[model samples]
Target: MLPTEKDAGSASMSQVSTSTERANQADVAYGRLKQLILDGTLPAGAQMLEQEAATRLEMSRTPVREAMVRLRQEGMVEIRPRHGMRVLPISASDMAEIYAVLTALEGTAAELVAQRGITPRQLAQLRGAVADMQTALERSDLKAWAAADEQFHLHLVRLSGNSRLIQMVGQLWDQAHRARMLTLQLRPTPSNSVKEHADLVDAIAAGDGPRARKVHEDHRRRAGTMLVDLLDRLGLNQL
Candidate 1:
């Protein structure tokens, strides 16, 4: 079930307090809505009633609408004439495009990390993220695992220290996150993911850009292919 806007708003408020809190509120709304859609809480083709969302989030229609706009831009939601907003169906072609962009960005990060020599501190952070993911996986906590996975990649991008690359990758990361959640939910093989992540980390730590890039590319391609196959089996491909 999607969280009520009130619940989301209250949670946000508890975490952030300031005059500039509106921006934070909007971000929270956007992330929560996006996660709901990705996790199938707001299943594909489900109408996004603004009033209901506002009521649930404990926020006004304005912020909910703003969130919808962002989701629309991310290809996770669509607005129809007289029909209201609907969660967009995931498509294989869209998945392909997203993975393509992600591959490029990750490859660039790998090269940069090797060229610049990632700091030991940054590597420690990366290792710590992997440990968190492992713990999440061991406990069968899909959400925590997913969050940790994202943090790991985002940390790598930050290590690259390229503002433009980080910004572009951030967008791609958001799209990829939704797809990843879907994939993990369908398959739920925590052990495999842990091993793959560990191997990638090892390559990165060794400063082997080519190896690291190859491992990352292979992992993504395999995961994407698995997700497409799962969607096909579930008859979600028609979407």
Candidate 2:
């Protein structure tokens, strides 16, 4: 029997709706699982089967499987044929490597922003982040300080107007998040770091590309060295 055009159209729409729903579900699963890992709820070296992940996420195996594939690609997890996924831990060596790449990428981002010139609104946003960091430190709230610090760097990268740089730096930041949070209290007070951020902001506002690059790169290199040294001294081979 030949189907009517209406019937074919309806069937096609239904297929499209179903596909969209599945993709949304996969995205939800991916975000939830990644957050769990980042917050240490899942913890490093944790392993679970496909069914377990589905059950925990309150979804079907299909979407959970799709999410696992993404995490695997991001170096956040490893999927075994039948073992589901294992959360990969970051070691001190991994920190060194991640930071090295971050230094170069973020330095270029700063230079670009300075060379191109930023708007007053954009400059205010960076200043606001620095102010927040200062307030957080004054209150002895390390967590809040960390959040503001992340925002400052995030704004720096975004101001570069380079999509690739933003994406790459974002991924590396996520990879280093757990380790940095874990070692926050162990590191020295961040007074100098805050000042450095302010200095970088000044360079950007003044359109001093070379100074901005040098300030940002030097800050990043020092931070990376300190973090790696802290991790090694504490014998945290795997974070």
Candidate 3:
């Protein structure tokens, strides 16, 4: 059937509006689900029911299902035959692998930033995130601290100005976030992390790439060791 001009314009607008609405819904679902997972509201190895999530988000199951699929692709969830969709459990070895990749990526990013020089606006944003992290630490807010920590790493990745690098590092960062939340929940003290992050910012501000790289690597390595130690204490070191 051929459509007249009026019909064509209306149809196009309808399609665009529908797409825009779907995109917004998906973002909302993904953000909520991701926050739930990171904040431990959705515990590791817990079942993820799409209908339940949809109900919670006040949306249809379709967007929730799509978000779960995205999370699965991000290594945040696993779909098992009998278990259905479940949050992946934290593992010491998995933490090691994630940090190893992150160390390389972030070190490279530091070098890039030093060579290219980050803009003042980017630096300001990074400092703002760090300040927020300090406030979270002072208030003993685990969720806020973790969120700020993620933003800090994300800012550095964006500074690298490499789309592929940003994407790869983001995936690793998400995995690391899960492990970090587990560790932070167990410990709940932010002294070590606070100092490490402060030193990182200092190095970056000084334009010391080598120092920044070393500091970044040390931070990841220390966190990885702590997670492994915690797992061992819990008698779950095999992970």
Candidate 4:
């Protein structure tokens, strides 16, 4: 017997759902693997085996492989022929370039937030992130400070109310985490938020788009320049 039109449509929908689920799983795998690299759980030049990563992540190898492919595309890892993937070692130039891109994306976010004006709930979240940064700094916890710094920028970008920008910036930020580790090691106080974020937050609160954007952009550029200088002074810029 021939299936009804509704049955055929349902079958197609089922296929689509299955495909989406697989994609979601791949995303999860990608995030987990990236975090490992970013946190130096899998440091630069570290090799990651597909089967091993799958076991560690408690997921199937299929999604892990897919995640590896995506990470390679993002330059986070390099796929070796018949060998485990290697985490790419970033250089000073790489950090500068990354900060440049972040500046643009987050600069736009600042503009958007200024234009739209942040709500009270969002404002509270931003304030909390700032306070967290201050606390981490006082304790000399660079790691916690880094985490709080991430949260503050993340909050600003998220408060922009642009989902696309949020996703794009988030991915780039993940890759930059490796560079950030180096930065923190070289400089004990590695945070733009400690100084720059406050002014930008104030600009945002005042609904000043141009001021916020300018402040954010300047902060990013300064950070980029500092990273380059640090690497150059340490004779690592060429390496």
Displacement of residue 25 (Cα, Å) in model 2 is: 1.0
Clash totals for all models, in order?
8, 0, 0, 0
- Give the least accurate 10-residue stretch of model 2, judged by summed lDDT: 185-194
The local distance difference test score of each candidate is 0.77, 0.95, 0.80, 0.85
TM-score of each: 0.74, 0.97, 0.81, 0.86
List pairs with backbone clashes in candidate 3: none
Clashing pairs in 1: 4-56, 4-57, 5-56, 5-57, 5-58, 6-56, 6-57, 6-58
Against the hidden true structure, what lDDT does model 2 obtain? 0.95
Model 3 collision count: 0
User: lDDT per residue, candidate 2, 95-158, as tens digits?
Assistant: 9999999999999999999999999999999999999999999999999999999999999999
> Whole-model lDDT for model 1 versus the true structure?
0.77
* Higher-ranked by lDDT: 1 or 3: 3
Per-residue lDDT, model 3, residue 13, is 99
**After superposition, candidate 3 runs with Cα above 4 Å error:** 80-84, 124-148, 185-195, 237-239
Error of 3 at 218 (Å): 2.5
Which tens-of-lDDT digit does each residue in 27-70 have in candidate 3?
88988998888777887878867777788899997777778888
- How far is 42's C-alpha from truth in model 3 (Å)? 1.5
Candidate achieving the largest TM-score: 2
Which model, 3 or 4, shows the larger lDDT?
4
